[model samples]
Target: MGDGRSGGGGANRPAWLQQYDLVGKIGEGTYGLVFLARTSHRKCCIAIKKFKQSKEGDGVSPTAIREIMLLRETCHENVVKLVNVHINHVDMSLYLAFDYAEYDLYEIIRHHREKLSHSINQYTVKSLLWQLLNGLNYLHSNWIIHRDLKPSNILVMGDGEEHGVVKIADFGLARIYQAPLKPLYENGVVVTIWYRAPELLLGAKHYTSAVDMWAVGCIFAELLTLKPLFQGVEAKATPNPFQLDQLDKIFKVLGHPTPEKWPTLVNLPYWQNDQQHIQGHKYDSHGLHNFVTVPQKSPAYDLLSKMLEYDPRKRITAAQALEHEYFRMDPLPGRNALVPSQPGEKIVNYPARPVDTTADFEGTVAVQPSQPVSSGNAASGNIAAASVAPSRSMPRSMHVVGMQRMPNAGISGPSAAAETKRSKYGNAESWLSSTEEALLRKPNGGHTCLFEIA
Candidate 1:
């Protein structure tokens, strides 16, 4: 149980956090460093987000507590699952565990920009966009506003074919909406600057889920363009940093913003004093290789334009976005093919966190070894008894065939004798635990793999 805190070199994870067998650091942020950990009983890998205690704070920060509370209250397929929470009594610090994923959307996009077959396809764009919106829909419906919505926060489940099971993670910045507030008018401030909605920039004091929608719009634009649509370089190292060309790039391609399209411009807290405005420029294919098509108005582009509306009011609802013709055109393929390092992967990295493998009955350890089940003795008229040998499929590792289980076959099957479908905890004579049955059984047509934990 390397709770991550220990003799300090980096941040010391307290010994109380040692319940998890720590693997390696997956990520770090202002608050806590993330670790990959596994539980003893369950071999499930979970992402553990350990909240760092602020020297100034009297106790766990209210923000961390709020995040845990909100995450526990909301759940959705598009949203990352909050597995559990651990509070160290010794230090009174808190840790949140979540389902581990292979990578985030940012990584996937960076790696497969040109490699993605659906780079410019309306079908693929629509599907991914729809998933993003669906997750947003769930959050907004619960009255939750995910203040930060960036590609990095949206994670891709695996590197396999089911690559786009995007889960919205990182709710530390989220705030519950009570009423709409005035939009911020600072132009290039708040949240992630590029994805920040106009209202936040305008200094809107009171806001609603629309803020998140605006960020969603930015993400959609990025997925299609590969490059961030509204990103401008910040003035290096100055608190007075400003994005002189905040809307320059956005307007340069999409055209100038007008009171007509965005009538609320005058109402923004930081509206320009000058009435002068810019007009749309001719579209250039500067960074739009496989990410976008040559023609801007392709179905995907049209859909993107709708999502990225400057006016939060005009921004499409996640549900409505899902219904858009794009998702209806081509349903995303099944998950088995898309997830790269699925349960089958030998050693997969998970977010460091503690998860209850017993709750799901899928003891953490993945099925790699064949268990020996005793069939009635050959002399006991059990000659007809047969068992399915376990199979290991590895793209990089050599394939090994299952060996004939003779009477002399030792309890632990040798690696050389690979079994395709052998029962776990070998020994059919060994009683099956409820957990094993649930995890190892074929639910419907697919073999179910529970989330791994340490």
Candidate 2:
């Protein structure tokens, strides 16, 4: 069996960990490393997110606690399911096991652009958008707001009963906005800079679910064009400075926001401070059709326009967007985003996510064996032979660095040079743009741990 233990063998490992075999390391972020593992009984693949101990020598990190709290209450096919929670009693590290998703929108988009040298099929795009909206609608209906909505966070199931289903993952920045004890703004900046809402960029203390819709609009555009709609360089500063470049990118295509367009525009903290730099710029309001390839009169364009409306109050709700005529048009959205609704349409086979066998579950580098360890079976044996001591303290502030993927061999795009320049801001990172040092800086007594299965 795969060795999940530390310096000692499997006998020294916790009882809860012995139930599964670590296949390989799949992803690594600010909080911890994610491993692909197989349950001993069912032999089904699962993603285990192992969070480092709190910096204060405390127990679990607040981000992990918050994710468990929010995910336990939510049950939907479109949302990623939290399977189990395990604790390494020896080190007090937290591990969250989730249903493994084999594909994400980022990889899929890159595949189409770099490998296939074509656009994603219209049916697949519609299905993905519809499913994303459906999941966001459920979250909104329950008063939750997924502050970070991006291509990498949107996951697609691999070969299984739920194949091609979209699962919205990552709940680190999610919060319940309904009847908050304190303004949601107190927690600091939220959402990745590229997909941030206009009101958020303008420093609006009081915001609504419309912010999520705006992100959905950006994702919809990316689904169509296979690129970030607003790929602007993020400003790295304390207290979350206003992202002028990001806002400028949005305004160039959608036009500058005015008090007439957004009634509450004058009340925002930044706008109220007489920011002459914002008012000095003038942009054409009808430039969206130029950026996105959709027909001006098409229902798809209408839905996108409504989602990207300058005023949050005027923005279309997820429930309302689902009923829009775009979905009602020819070749309706299907249940499976990867499968074609009509027969005889070629199915696009997306490559599985890459796994790094050299990285151990303990977030330490290990030597690769002479013969590669098989990822398919549990008894193939563990690769973590050498144990590297992990740091007890982690940085208080965390920023999610984008997971790098290997491009298909011998396949290059025509705009590879342009893409390389944009990759610095667009693909190299998935920033949270937080104002405070800690991700969840609030006092922790209010949230109860709900998903501690182990």
Candidate 3:
């Protein structure tokens, strides 16, 4: 831990303050910094996610809270594990400790691209895809939508044994879509621009996990081709109703969507208003056949086709895709993606993760290391719930994704005396020990990989 002391009087800190020794800054983001740490008692490795106050100088940011709650409740091998949480009484700062992972899909793809000697084999691809889908299926089945699903957000353990154990990290933009208290549309401008679904770009008020599925389809293509299939320049924010440039990029490769293909297509705000300007109708003749050249006629193509289906309702469900013929093919999916199929084949070597011991966490937010420009970025922003427009979908009394409480329920915060209240942990300041897992994961120098030190 650099300096170790975080603001306020040194000795007069919360009980949890002395529990761990901070190591070094692993990564930084808009909200805060993630540090590699170990517990004082057991010396178990942990990834501490520290969040500075929001602009108003309040408690934890709502986005951080959403992540804590989601990770705490979710228990899956493929999902990042949240070990414990703590709050600085003096500064009102928030911190979450999670199990550490080694590598991310972003780094993996970059490694393959930059390296001349090696490439990701097909068996590894099948394995990584299977694990990713497994985690995503868990999220969707729980009614939670991972609004941002890209290479960076998908983590892989560098433990060597669990080669295919991909942990879906970053829940800052994740929300439970079950019977939402506010219209799902209220959370506008979600998912990274590239992975964003066609329906969302068209300004569809009502959408579902299919949006996530669409992103997965994009990811699937990227893994196969070692590049983003639809690398559209993100349109600058505007008051207008459409993202014409992004839509055009998709149409140029996948062909224009017709009313016959997606029944509700014409009703969407962007498509209805700007149908005249949308170009590239002729590209539909070949569909995805022309775009994805490496993957030939197989069940993998079937799964990709279903995932990229224009009609979201018809998009392949996570469970269904897992059972696709693509997975059942000869090089059947494996548990260890990195393990070579042939016994004598070499185990791919990836670089070690860099640690910035000098990154000060005493004040301000940490910035992630910028990544090299590829076809486009993997992910960056998620503007859900920042919309200026009134929600168009019907509101209900149940839960809404990313919201602290039900709509109109009022502000949510813990009482100053909340320590005296009964909690899952004995006191408000508590610890839930995780295995403190640290695999050999690395981040590319070019990309800004953030969240729980994955």
Model 2, CA-based lDDT: 0.72
- Between which residue pairs do clashes occur in model 2? none
Indicate the residue-level lDDT of 211 in model 1: 74
- TM-scores across all candidates? 0.64, 0.80, 0.75
**Candidate 1 residues 333-433, lDDT tens each?**
22221222234433322221222222111113322222211111223222221111224232221111231212212324322122311233232112223
Regions of model 2 farther than 4 Å from truth: 1-9, 369-454
Give lDDT tens digits, candidate 2, residues 1-454. Answer: 3364422246655566777777677777767878877788887888888887666656556677667667776777888999887655455567889998878888889888899888898878888898898888777766678999999889987655676789999887886555423466876888888899989888888788899999999999998888888898888874763788898899988988889878899888777664676877677765789989799999999999999999999999987988888887766776567765565566666766666766666655556532222223223444221111122121121111231212322225324422432443231112222311233343442222224543
Give the lDDT of residue 77 in candidate 2: 81
* Candidate 1: segments with Cα more than 4 A from true spot: 1-16, 89-92, 114-124, 159-164, 180-189, 235-242, 273-291, 331-454
lDDT of each: 0.52, 0.72, 0.64
lDDT score for residue 393 of model 3? 20
**Clash number for candidate 3:** 8
Could you tell me the lDDT of residue 313 within candidate 3?
90
lDDT of 3 at 340: 62
